[model samples]
Target: MPTFADPFQQHQAEQLLQPVLIRVVDNLRKAMEASNWIGTYEEHLLWPEGTTTAEQEQVRQIAAQLEDADPEAAQHLQEQLSHLPMPFPGYELRLSQGEHTQRIDVWNLCYQVCFTHYDPDTPAEVDPHLLDEVGDVDWLALDEKAQQLVQVAFEQLGEGRKD
Candidate 1:
């Protein structure tokens, strides 16, 4: 297995993983875009106490129309909304060393608006911590194929060197 004792090898491993990281991030962005309606629904939930019941009903009507018009999109949106009161999707990366391996995390934040809202001027008011409920990519939880690639990269770093 590759050991990250050497700086040069560590850099090389990071370089090798760059493309994979980019692809994952792109896929995440696409998923977020597809589920954009969740943002609007969440905004409605945050409406002030003075918000009229009729206005709330209008929100429900709009959601119903969206479901009728685009079932697939509506389903996607609903799936996201199910995780409600959570943060939006923003990209972040983290690297850590473990007892037997290195860990890389591709995380998300609510800093960026992941969905479209009814009114751009009025964005959802939410606590920042609530938006950090999900991690887009967690190295430790990756599939076998990805885990192997990462292991191989680390192993290569340990090549021709003693740690």
Candidate 2:
């Protein structure tokens, strides 16, 4: 959301931000793919994002109480789960492709798409090189694109819109 000094810098920032955005989108897509979010069960709450042993146990505990809730429904049943300890505990996706490793929160990204008031500070967290080059980004536009990508992913996975 930063301004650029010139049109060229603006273009460069846009170019540089593309992969970061894709990575962020992929973080969500991959998390969805990493596990089966169906069936209202405790085991369903477990995902690849939480790697630590403590985190795994936390999910196990959260799963036990969700006798009638699903992992996918967490966004909807927040009030139900609020009193219980969090399952994500920090839904940080550790992306290690090639030489660099970065952590992103797919859970937060999903929320941010719906509630835009949250700080879009991820660009800076990934790398200042990206933050320095970024121009004012149309986050709503990017969020829409992310939604499209999620739809495509669901299609590829043969997931249906269940109410």
Candidate 3:
């Protein structure tokens, strides 16, 4: 039998990693789709900053720790939401309470709205000017093209039905 250091063995190991890598990418794409931040591109529905970047970093760390054959196992993780129009300009969705609101940027970046307390329990009578300070928004959620891709990914990721 060939030793672990053998070139042929390494090639076989690389081949074995292909499927796992594909699954990782698919799952990533699906997740990006379901998120509230929308993608900048209409074609592939890709987001590049904020939570997306954070997730990408996490995947990068995972792949770096894995064996050489699967070094890029978690690379290219993203999800596609859908092609629906966002509620606000440059923002897809707004999760808000009273005058406080959390806005998602064009690439899904989250900007915390703070002034009279952005906490959800804040009184509804809080000043509206604070909301203005929160500033204009970008894409709030993922694009529409990503919806189905996200569902498939979630199913494959072991998120089973409630029943």
Q: lDDT of all predictions, in order shown? A: 0.37, 0.46, 0.32
Model 1 compared with the native: what TM-score? Answer: 0.21
lDDT of 2 by residue, 32-114 (tens): 55534331111124334435776556556555655566766655455544544454233444544345344444445543332
**C-alpha root-mean-square deviation, each candidate:** 19.5, 14.9, 23.2
Candidate 2 lDDT: 0.46
How many residue pairs of model 3 clash at the backbone?
Answer: 26
Write down the RMSD of candidate 1 (Cα, Å): 19.5
* Candidate 3: stretches off by over 4 Å: 1-4, 37-163
Specify the poorest-scoring 10-residue window by lDDT in model 3.
Answer: 106-115
Q: Which regions of candidate 1 fall more than 4 Å away from where they truly are?
A: 1-3, 7-9, 37-163
User: What does the lDDT come to for candidate 3?
Assistant: 0.32
TM-score of 2: 0.26
Task: Give Cα distance to truth, residue 6, candidate 3, Å.
Answer: 3.1
Residue-level lDDT for 54 in candidate 1? 70
- Model 1, 16-132: lDDT tens digits are 344345444444444334421111111113444455677556556556666676778887767654543332233332222333232222321211112122133453232222122
Backbone clash total for model 2 is 1
